[model samples]
Target: INKDTFHLSQRDTENHQTNLQKFCRICGGSFKSDPYKRSYPVHGPVDDDTQALLRKKEKRATSWPDLLAKVFKVDVRGDIDTIHPTNFCHNCWNMIQRKFSNSPSEVYFPREGTMEWHPHSSSCDVCGTSFRGIKRKKRSLNPQLSKKPRMVAGSARKARPVRNVKQVSNKAVMKRIANCNKIHLSTKILAVDYPVDFVKSVSCQVCEHILADPVETTCKHLFCRACVLKCIKAMGSYCPACRYPCFPTDLVSPVKSFLNILNNLILRCPVKDCQEEVVLGKYAHHFSSHKEAEEKEGYAYINKGGRPRQHLLSLTRRAQKHRLRELKLQVKAFAEKEEEGDVKSVCLTLFLLALRARNEHRQADELEAIMQGKGSGLHPAVCLAIRVNTFLSCSQY
Candidate 1:
């Protein structure tokens, strides 16, 4: 046995019957070693994309394994626990979903998890590479153990991801995890279990909870960051409390003194068996020590990634600000082409970007909104060009 790290390697060497579970049968990509790439069995109905496509294409619905066997001549019927079952990584699954043929547009590579896959070619028909251990002079351990994948496609049966208790049990981490879903965050959060009568003025109208990451509107109404966004979407771009027309850029942070009140609120840890009470302003400082949680959460920023959700929220806001800058530049450049309706084109394009590319069609929508006195605000770069005014962003635009 090697000294520094004892014989878990020995156990893995001696075990057998599960060596192939580490790879995707279609691509031969290694997901088990990296833990980030999404993997799924070829045996069952996986996602809505698969189901909808199956319903539209075939009169009789079939499991993925059945479909793969029929179309690709690849068989994956054996269960992994007993035999070497075929599986597919997310990229390979997408290729099959988009087209059902002998040749796919792209062929996933054996080292795909570490490197990019190649575009389809005639030689790719063989898909000729796979990495396997030689079994060697000493009987190598091939331990049979199920690993909880980061993302699996189906809900009917899914493995729960394991969390390190030691990581979650650390004092600083326990404090952060305790407040992960509980404290001030960008998205509309669950109502606090504790009373909020003292901070009633800042409570979100939709959630009836103390405002966490509050947003101030052009109409002077206040709401939790996601609460206002969701409300406006539901109300067809109208403000939550008032019917005043609003756009995403119209939501700014509250004034410094007003915000300082919310930031100063002391939160008692609501998670069970924890006694840490921390100031909202200082809560973020403790987050750096929680690297273990970061490893499990991976590179995602969504709330389901769990602890340090606030930090992720901050990152998301920064990315949006960057997007806003790009959008401003794109609008300014595109608007100059339609110089006759330059101001209106910039306004309408920012809102109806997903609509038709024709400027005339968008100009009509902008004219209607203008007639109704619902013109959206302009980005700072073009603020002088258009006759629109903006409130100073407390968080700094």
Candidate 2:
């Protein structure tokens, strides 16, 4: 293992399902013969590095206030009526109804010790609503056995109790099972229990205006989709309440229903001094049109391998011209020195200037090259050398 440490080795020894070690009969020392069983010393102590990294991680963890701002921008305590564990009041029930509109929903009834699944019965509750509920089976092991069922003799089949023999179809049971499986698969595929178009009745806690369908954040916080978008545009791209990291694409949902809701409730334009409303369907297009979009896109294009935006190409061209102008000025000074007959000084000055200029020009050239969508292998020296060779060759000619 020590010899193999510096060099790469692929060792595979698998077949054995169990291992038995030999014990010395005299000393009782257990032995493992395999070299892989031995432990080696690590190069250095990692406590300091680990501590520093841990500190950095803790720093990265968002504060509660920041998180709350992103998600619960409005007062959650105010909006969600507090309910006792025994039962949900009308307000909490209304909130749940507003959140999840379809398929009967209910709350936990602590008194009954069960999750109420049935919709509140309207006749029973006098609110014209039935408390939706589903009973869960309580199971336990009992030491005592109940009385055994008596078996009847096969010959006495005619003596069996004669009554109405209602024939039941097996297909009906199979259909029920199939329906259950379909529901299970659908929930699995979507990863969330989505209520259909229920967000419409939900209102912003701050504005008190009925929300135009809500968007679900990964943290499970709900918001008027447009309101959150506006918040992001106003703030530096982060989750409104928690300052959780986010991206425009993070809002996408695979399910058509959720996507449709998102499409219907997009935020207004996030630009400062601009009060234009951004329709849900047109958000992507609008964000793409921002003044900084091309610049940001250019950075992504060069460093992140995305397509360069049009404005980025223009900016790069302008920067290249500026670099070319600076290079010409230095070259002019070199010519003036050369004409004064100070050949060694002129050459040395030119060489140093070329080296320094190359570094500055490289940055500009990289911008240009990325704008042109070229690979990064080309060097500033190659371009500089070409210019020098051209000058030398022309002078000789």
Candidate 3:
């Protein structure tokens, strides 16, 4: 055969071979096909049996439709009363068969036992402090291999092997610790007392407020979960502190040690007049009372300040009332001016005010209908008049 014909035949053979390679119909993992090995067809009946067993053992009715949808990545058309035949790899077939055939072995105690000395030291390697109970074993680094040069294909010079640096320098370690000081600082637990500088580093850089439910980015910079989420939503996926590219998914839960510290920290009441020092765990409950008190005081203050600057208040009220009246007149005149094609200013201002009100109340449906010129149960003229009246009344002291 000619070279071109032989190459074409070889390409076709590869394509055929790839097409013949079967995937595990159950798990969806690629099955390794061997010429010498015999393939077995493990149908979905075994899967149903295993699932039944699992449900029985767990004593809970588990829905497989959601899981099947994710696995198949298709909208299932009908109810799955029965599963179709599937081709399973040898290992998967064996595993399913063994699971069905065998029962789990129970734990049993030995009649005699012997004890040996633990290989771990009684003190921490880094801090050189004695451990309370059983000390944790120190992790030993692998022995460094000698670098050897290797000859590369089509290259005259030999390529030198890259030396892997495993040992961290003391300065680099200290710098990393300093960078993570924010997490340690916020921790109130005395179990691991950090430096004063570390303790003071718990505040968010954006709001300069004590971090709550802190999430750390890939760059090691920490921020409050809400603050960071808001920043990311408003801006783009980038760390506010270091400007390092970070996604919401990259924000990880703080370590258990940090969580313990955060929960135990003493926080002051956020209200201006309240001087209550609250535990971090109890802050949520305490803050609610503080907020209610502040709101009550605010209403009381508004009522008490009625006659303090009566003249100035009266002037401001009169100005607001005049503006409201002018707006109302303009809206009224729009019906006639609309026919003359001069309704943009009056209509737009009224629409904008309605939109502002809708946004403030988060009534998206009402806003959409209003924007479409569909009155929300009330006549547009009546709504505008009511809004203007409310605005004028609110402006009055």
Give the better candidate number (1 or 2) by lDDT.
1
- The digit string of per-residue lDDT tens for model 1 on 115-233 reads 22333233432122322342335645446635533445665244333344443343333233224344444222223343555455666655555676888765566777776675556
Report the C-alpha lDDT of model 3 over 293-395, residue by residue, as the tens digit: 8689877735445456344345776676764686667666775666464566456556666767655433433453466586566656665665565568776
What is residue 345's positional error in candidate 2, in angstroms?
31
**1-397 in candidate 2: lDDT tens per residue?**
7768434321211101011112111111223332433211112122343335435546331232232233223222222111101112232222222222222333221222212122222232211111122234465545575754455787467655443221123223322322333111111122223464443323332122333345554434445556556555654445444344444544533346655654555355646766566555665577668857768877663545666544524667677667468666776676676566554455554554564466555544444344446755567786565445545866621
Cα lDDT computed for each candidate against the true fold: 0.53, 0.38, 0.50
TM-score of 2: 0.19
Worst 10 residues of 2 by lDDT: 12-21
Model 2 residue 189 distance off true place after TM-score fit, in angstroms: 33
Is 2 or 3 the stronger prediction by TM-score?
3
Q: Native-vs-model 3 lDDT?
A: 0.50
> What's every prediction's RMSD, in angstroms?
27.1, 30.8, 21.6
